[model samples]
Target: MWPIGRSFSSQNLFLCLVICQVVVCMLFVIYRNTQSLEHRLAILTSRWAAREDGFDFPEGPWNVTDSDVVRCSDLINGRFPSEAAINRTIDAIRETVIKDYEFIELTRDCTKFAWERGYYNKPITKEELDFPLAYTILMYRSVHQVEQLLRTIYRPQNIYCIHIDSKSPPLVHIGMERISRCFDNVFIASNLENVYWGTINIVKAERHCQKDLLNRTDVSNWKYLINLTGQEFPLKTNLEIVQILKEFKGQNDIRTLAQPVEEWTYYRHVLEGDTIRQTTLLKTEPPPDKVPVHKGPFFSALARQFVEFLQSDIADKWLEWFNDTKNADESFTQTLASYPNAPGGPGPIGSKAIISRDIVWSSERLRERRPCYGKFVRRVCVHSWRDLVRVSKSIRLFANKFHVEYDGLVLQCLEEAIHNKTHNPPMLTFHFIDDFSSSE
Candidate 1:
């Protein structure tokens, strides 16, 4: 009996040992799995933390911040689109395109495939985006198209201006109305005065536009002006334009003509000599607030303060001169803006100015008023696919006259140019706020 009991005890001890070994193995596995999961969680947390901060990005004309604007301008010049760009664009589309919505939106609306189908192969550099505006004018007499074009480019803020001669058809007014419907940030000339080629009318109209700009207090809040005509179109997508401008906003010197009124006289008169003759006439009444005198170009992005100056009392003499003078169109704004120490503060404000003077002049030398020396006579037409491609490459925010029927073409071109690759490249660096990881 003692031997049997001893055997049972030994057997029981062996069973207990086996059970303990199994438990140990299972515990080891559980511990390892928990450690592995913890490591994975830590890694994910670290990655998220890094992203909360930004990666180093390329500098200039790019920002993740919301409040930024970009400014670039080109005179209307008709240059065709590039083949390689079209192909790459189409390739990207094919890779991403799916479903009927994509077909209509990406293919039909954008017209990216049309160019890849070998429509025309004109090379367009970033520097050569001046043609669409010229073509839009020659084809369409509509001044409202300029506003549409500005919409395609992305800027934190935007203002568009359109200038039409008194000679422009009644449809011009209709076009202006159409523009008003589409864009709220546009300025259309309220006074439709006759613009004799060599007479003061052109300058008068320009002054009127400037006066409107100067009168506004809100316009100054903007960082840039597009100064476009009805015929111009955008080459870069709004996203791209916004990105580029955001990167370069404060850094670039492309502010509109917002120089203080006092500076205008000094630089224009003493330094540039754009104005040789200045007639100083004292106003007996000291006219109520300054009249807007000849400012350059119907379409310009004036700085807010500069515009205010144009509306100030200092601009009174200049405006009086513009309204009364005959050949003032030729030199009124230029002269008054440049006169040294003229009563007004230096006038033309802004970092740079681009003048678009592509109009066909008749053989009749402008004997009646000051002659326009360099006006391209051939009217512009943007009917064909080639025309659309060419105009899209212009990269100008504003353009001139387009026929009413060409609105579809203009809109299409504008949309495509905005979406192009070169216009919106990825930023080199990224940024994140501190405590992003710690809080999580």
Candidate 2:
């Protein structure tokens, strides 16, 4: 130390040193590496400026951190909430929700809307672009929530097939249509359904979207198909998703090998319109061709080949049989994967546990009495602020069941978390950072 302090001389005198960190956030977080100062400044300015200069230099979509916008960034990024802060958040959320302050009106102009929302115009990476995705999004209500979900998952390379329940009001359809018009890659399925819980229409709605996605020649190169409801949101960034999915190579992400619930298939059950209980009963037929039926969430990430199989004569027979079964959506795709002559490429090889689609069924955790601060919808938890801290470390890619009416703070926090990670990347501290630096 003493010797070095006396001399500042070097042979070239041109060498310079810079500091950087390999900041890794939990589970599948990916941030762009080593940006130029001008580029960083452009990102900082994109919030209001939303200019083409920023969109030209692609890394990820520009996002406004909803937490900072709502004043909850500190409390959610691992800091314990003070009582006053909690009360303040509560008051702000109540005020905003009652007045509907957070909602943004969407228009049909793709250029203006995209610039206003700061969608990534180009592919972030060659890897992500080549592995385009197709989404079968089932959304019945809440246009704002659906828009946020679309913004989070949207990429020009992917195609989205949105199915709005035919039972919803005209405003819901109008709102969805407005949003859909703003993106060429997104569209409403021609065949929509009057979906009801535990009813045939539930499965019919999703099948319709798969059929639509497959028919689209524009985004036909899409390799994977992920299904989602308006309430579900992605936990990982697009870049990270591409990485994880590429690792999968070709295997589908779904759960199987579940014990038979005879009541589900043996009896016909129908849920009344907008009602929680089933009032109808009739004899149900056994699965066609004696195929092995498996139980899992209807929401899944599938391969294109499997979706093709779903449209064939063989799958039509199964669909016809399942029309009378209770909650057939939960079993339809899973059963098809286990079928003897099904796609064969998507399954019978992957793990039984569902790693891609994540959901916390509050009903299953009753023995431990884990606190579900969020309200339960059809036995699934609608995420609340308390869930934010816990989900930050979840290994799963996408999480299900978020209701803005339930508690938007958690959604805001999550959106901000992903936003900050996408634009302003890692910091060495355990806390969140509004700064980024790296090398690819």
Candidate 3:
């Protein structure tokens, strides 16, 4: 009986030992899982914090804060900050949040304020008193940029025709209409075109604006017609532009290249269908028009006589011939400028006198001197703040491809510079005359 009792006690002790080992293993696993969960939670919290702070983000133009406005005002008033200081501020806000809805509402409110306050109304000086310049602005986006451009170049005597791309967002159309209604000199184009790059639609859009401007009987004071894009900013003041135009003395500034039509010009596009559209490139024969083919940049400033010629039968014939031609915008105007007997043709003034735009092509030389702000699209460089010094010193009346989102400082400084020049006209010194002559 004593031996049996001892065996039962031994078995009970072994069972207790096994149960203790199992409990210890289970506790270790629970502790490790808790630690892992805490680590995961910490990582998620850090990610959210980074996003909220806008770290590592490029600043957007519409992200202007009250402090930024104060700084800009200071700069305009000649409290110039060092380049490094400016860059630091810009970098700090580079990743500022962008809300599309807020941007649209801001545009509407600003337009209303400008209209009520007459912010753009200014007295015309003798230099531009009688000389009216016509402008056609082709815009697809950037409502704020457009408004800034209008305010900067505003003159009661000048007429502006804005053509919003038919494919643009509804907000863009609404903003443009509201802004145009504010001034008698500004009007939206009745005929809007769906513009495609390197397509005839661009030329058609310009022609529509020109025709609308010419048909308006309410205003008859315009003398020169300058075509512009939304990305272009005027480097010269209105008075300066007027003086330069007067120097031309009735000649047009249209660049042209007298050369045979390249093979690439023969490429054509075929649309798949009306609703679900797909474009297919097809190589076609050279333009049927027997006239010599010429190529040039799309932008120009033409005299009223030349603009009228574009509305004549001869211009219509060239337009029809180039309807199917690829990259017609580059050739249509050039062909007209090179045509015999045309107002801006190879006449007494010569084609060089007609060339005015300061376009920076994406050549090896340009890449070496001035690096592009953003990636090149279609081989064109988008101007950034880095190019501000070079562009400001340029002799051209206007520069192309400035994006507010890319670098707001360039445009901001440019506006201040222009305003300063206007308010305090420079003295007429011999050096000024020499600089003016060299620019011409």
TM-score for each candidate, following the candidate numbering: 0.40, 0.75, 0.71
lDDT against the true structure, per candidate, is: 0.37, 0.66, 0.67
Query: Tens digits of per-residue lDDT for model 1 on 1-440?
Result: 11224587777877777899999999999888755632422211111211111211112332122222211111112222344543344354344323222223323422343344222222333322321111111112433333334344423234444556666666655554443334344556556556554344565666566555444454444433334444545443333333333333232212123332432322222112322332343324432244333334344333344444445565566655444333444344344444344433332223233322222124435423323222333433333232332343332333443432322433444344344333433222221111211321
Assess candidate 3 and give its lDDT: 0.67
lDDT digits (tens) for residues 32-131 of candidate 2: 3324332332222101222222211222322333342334344344443454565567567655542112222547466778877657642366667788
lDDT string, candidate 3, 118-203, tens digits: 45555466657778899999999877787778888888778899999999988788778877776788899999998877667888
Model 3 misses residue 61 by how many Å?
A: 29
Counted clashes in each candidate structure: 68, 1, 4
Evaluated at residue 50, the lDDT of candidate 1 is 19
Model 1 misplaced stretches (Cα beyond 4 Å) = 1-140, 143-157, 161-167, 214-220, 235-301, 322-333, 336-415, 421-440
RMSD score of candidate 2 (Å): 10.6
Candidate number that wins on TM-score, 1 or 3: 3
RMSD of each: 18.6, 10.6, 26.8
Regarding lDDT, does 1 or 3 come out ahead? 3
**lDDT agreement of model 1 with the native:** 0.37
